[model samples]
Target: MTTTQSSISSTSPTPTVPSGSGRVANIVLDSFTEAGRHVRIIPRNIEVLIFATIQPVMFVLLFSFVFGGSIQVPGYPDYDQYLMPGIFAQTVVFGSVFTSVGLAEDLSKGLIDRLRSLPIVQSSVLIGRTLSDLVRNIITFIAMLAVAFVLGFRFEGSLTSAAAATALLLLFSYGLSWVQALIGLSVGSVEAANSAGFLWMFPMTFVSSAFIDTRNLQYAWLRTVADVNPFTQVTNAARALYNGTDPGDAVMWSLVWSIGLVVVFAAIATRKFKTSSE
Candidate 1:
């Protein structure tokens, strides 16, 4: 009995995490590690990459060729150039649904439970997933850009301005990822999460200046909504920047909208993550 007691006592106690900076560092490190895991999984799930690439490519092709001739932009020489930026913006925004479906799958498979069993931070899983999705979005952007190039879409602006526009789109997509993360955590299944994720995006993208000029919308309310829609702001900003037109206040508003979304949705997602974990 004494030997048994000694043996039990001698066994190492469960490690205790240090408070303050150390804890924060651990969370950051764990987030990167989780992000790496997600990146690695992409190769095995090639269908995700394929499906993500196909829709945007098709959009770029169909809109540039079939619809380009009929679409009239008052100042643009070629409608294809004007259409590409909106297509890119729409693609990134739609890409965010991948985050929702991925998170829902993880939750359904009890991956969250398994991760929770470890010493990692609770929010790291969501952060990592979003980060990975951002990387994936970058890939999708490249593919779409290639397709756009083939369809006669050329950047009229300096390379620096073009890069800035790309960055803004990615930032906006990252913000939307957090919103999708919240949806994923809230929904019971992947299918439900996918549906819930795109339910708002359809209206959000269609009602904006993505395909048609906001001023052309027949409905007064739609024009008003499109004027204020963040997606419209981003799309318009991207179009101006890429086409070398004066962006006016569109860039500023796009930045504000993206930052606002990140702030709002990140908080909501973090809270939902904690609740779901418990």
Candidate 2:
């Protein structure tokens, strides 16, 4: 019995996972799994749902009922139809900001360091943050859909197309989260990270083809910019899914953007994290 107690007491504490090959995959999976377990503990889940649902719902009604009749798209039947998909893309895409803010908060509170010491997978920090946010965004998407239905926005596409649209949106959101995660790691300050994450969305969402068609713009340059914006691709993809319009090249563009962001930002964020650790 004494020898057994000594053996138990001699056991070493778990070591923090070391960064190396396949570290990222392990980190991301672990973080994602841990985040999933704590979903109910996060107040942000409710906040995200409310924000995602209410804002889009209001925009849908405001545009469709108030101004929809006044504005018309040449190839579209009505304004609400054009506006609904845009709102989905705009609202969900903006969710990337939360990824950074959450990471910043974790770092600021030293929760990241604690996790780092827990024998976790090396890339777990970045992966966890990205995957967790992806799950949250999915919830937000569902809530937004509920709101959309209540406001009379209907999907005209096959269920398969709609499911494909959701998958694409989630993929794009995950890729964007990697960039946001890097921003959080670099800033290492919750307030600054939050501001940086959100500030870009203003120009990205408002100045594009989200609410108004580019053709209606008085400025040729503004029209040109909106026409080429990556965001327009996402909205167009969503529109295709909603109205049964052929996804065309917009889906391709969306996929390119998502994959590109993941590669670029994951590399940057991982580098920053390693540098910070060293």
Every model's TM-score: 0.92, 0.86
Task: Give lDDT tens digits, candidate 1, residues 92-211.
Answer: 999999899999999899898999888788889999999999999998999889888887788899998999999999999999999999999999999999999999999999899888
| Model 2 Cα lDDT, one tens digit per residue, 1-278 | 33444565356876455564575566566777667754654554576567656776777778778888788887777677778778778777778887888888888888878877777665767776777778777877887788777777778898889888878778877887898988888785889998999888878777777788778889998888888887877777878887888989989998999899999988888888867878
Model 2: CA > 4 A from native: 1-29, 37-40, 43-48
How many residue pairs clash (N, CA or C atoms closer than 3 angstroms) in each of the candidate models, in the order given? Answer: 0, 5
Top candidate by TM-score = 1
lDDT of 2 at 121: 61
Show model 1 residue runs off by greater than 4 Å.
Answer: 1-21
